[model samples]
Target: MKPAIALPLLGLAPLLGASDLLVKALGIALVALPLLSLFGLLLPVLRRALSGHALWFGALLLAGVLVGLAQLLMQAFAFELHRALGPFLALLALPCLLLVAIEPAGPGAGLRQGLLFAACALLLGALRELLGHASLLAHGEWLGLGALHWQAAADGLPLFASAPGGLILLGLLLALVRLKP
Candidate 1:
């Protein structure tokens, strides 16, 4: 599958997790981008050590290890952020594995995909926080930072904070991106 299409699909879990809070989204992006790029850079070295099914399994193992390490670091430095991520943190490995299995493997491809994912996560997170709660970075304290709440004049649409609503928004956003000129 094309990275453009595959990434958004595989990233649905993280997107939902991120959509609830901007700080969580930032954390997800910060952790994901580097880990993915590192995975891409190390792909060739792993390929040289294993082949066929072993390569696939080994790649997944490496991705899992990276994800685990990231989780540990998040837990250490940002415990609340790590707790907020929950299962979505583990699910991150799925996208990494997919990226590795896809064509045009390299640091550049990983970086491109990472940027795309980060943009989507941040946009969705900010929009949801704004629309659902009438605020932004309401949980900034999770990262030991002061909350950067932006209160709106009126009430927010509540739906944007939920999974179904996020899915709807994601569909609309993806549709907009895929539109022809």
Candidate 2:
């Protein structure tokens, strides 16, 4: 629920909305999805280290630090992506903080939530980038794999880049997911 609102809001970069397929392919999709998963992995540690309300407050701070570290790592290793993603990376800690504040520590709950989060982020990112930009996979050189570059022309609807458009797209997607087999 949090991510359904959060993912499209944060993923509005030109890199994501590139008109080229290769650029979209090598964009932040790799880094962005796993960061949430890593936060999930860290949640238990944060919970164990800080009991009571301290865990709630401390987890937010810790998640910010973790996201910052990830930003630094991306800057050091993948400078182009770090530059491309820019301030958007700061948004990654949001779900982590929310998760820590709201969810109880249950067996495999974090895992389930993390996987769902990753899947949703990936799907939302793809939809927002593809439909909004009129491109599928774009920019492989950012990942240092130039050989994988590819792009097809797309006229593209302009609205998917906008929040209202994303909300509509998300609504339709949610409806599709809820349909019974």
Candidate 3:
């Protein structure tokens, strides 16, 4: 994402917490990203149609409406996941707005972000669930992926189950990814 978006994504957080929620994290990334990009695509047009003051107000209204629509969709398609996602879904609007603030050079931009996030989400979710919960895809049933999960007979590291531990695990993962070849 452009700096416009990255700044907000980093700040709104709980995106990191999504790792703890597994299925809910996947649901948001799969469902919300496209809607965000679609709304984002229209930002330039809306910005052009309205002046400075109206632009801010219009964007806010649009963001709210979009968020509502996203929530409704979540409620409809992923009711359980939506409930699990809780208010964190509201924070998604920040990324949507930031993504739209800067024009994309091509259609692939959103796809790139979505795919990368999805992959990271998968890795983080799996890692957290494995070490933190001693299970892989523990809530897979919540997303109709029951076959994908299996609980272990042994216990896991309880620390990874918490938010701060997710951050630590994430930092460790980042370091691993950034290691020089």
Q: Which candidate ranks first by lDDT, i.e. highest?
A: 1
Compose the digit string of candidate 3's lDDT tens values, residues 34-101: 75566656666776788667876887788778888888988998788888878877766665555555
The top-ranked prediction according to TM-score is: 1
Q: How good is model 3 by TM-score?
A: 0.80
Better of 2 and 3 by lDDT: 3
lDDT of each: 0.80, 0.60, 0.70
1-181: candidate 2 lDDT, tens digit per residue: 2345545333333223331233432344455456656667777887778888798788778777877887888888888867756665676666566566555655455455545555554676567667766655444466766675434486567687565665676668777977999
1 or 2: which has the higher lDDT? 1
Q: Please give the distance, in angstroms, between residue 141's alpha carbon in candidate 1 and its true position after superposition.
A: 1.3
In model 1, the clashing pairs are none
For candidate 1, lDDT tens digit of each residue in 44-151?
A: 788788888998899899999999999999999999888888888887787677765677456576777778878888988888888888888888888765645567
Candidate 2 error regions (>4 Å): 1-29, 32-34, 105-107, 145-150
| Higher-ranked by lDDT: 1 or 3 | 1
Clash pairs for candidate 2: 21-137, 21-138, 22-137, 22-138, 22-139, 23-138, 23-139, 24-138, 25-138
Which residue segments of model 3 deviate by more than 4 Å?
1-12, 51-56, 100-107, 176-181
**Model with the higher TM-score, candidate 1 or 2:** 1
Compute the lDDT for candidate 2.
0.60
Please state the error at residue 120 of candidate 3 in Å: 2.7
Q: In angstroms, how far off is 89's CA in candidate 1?
A: 0.6
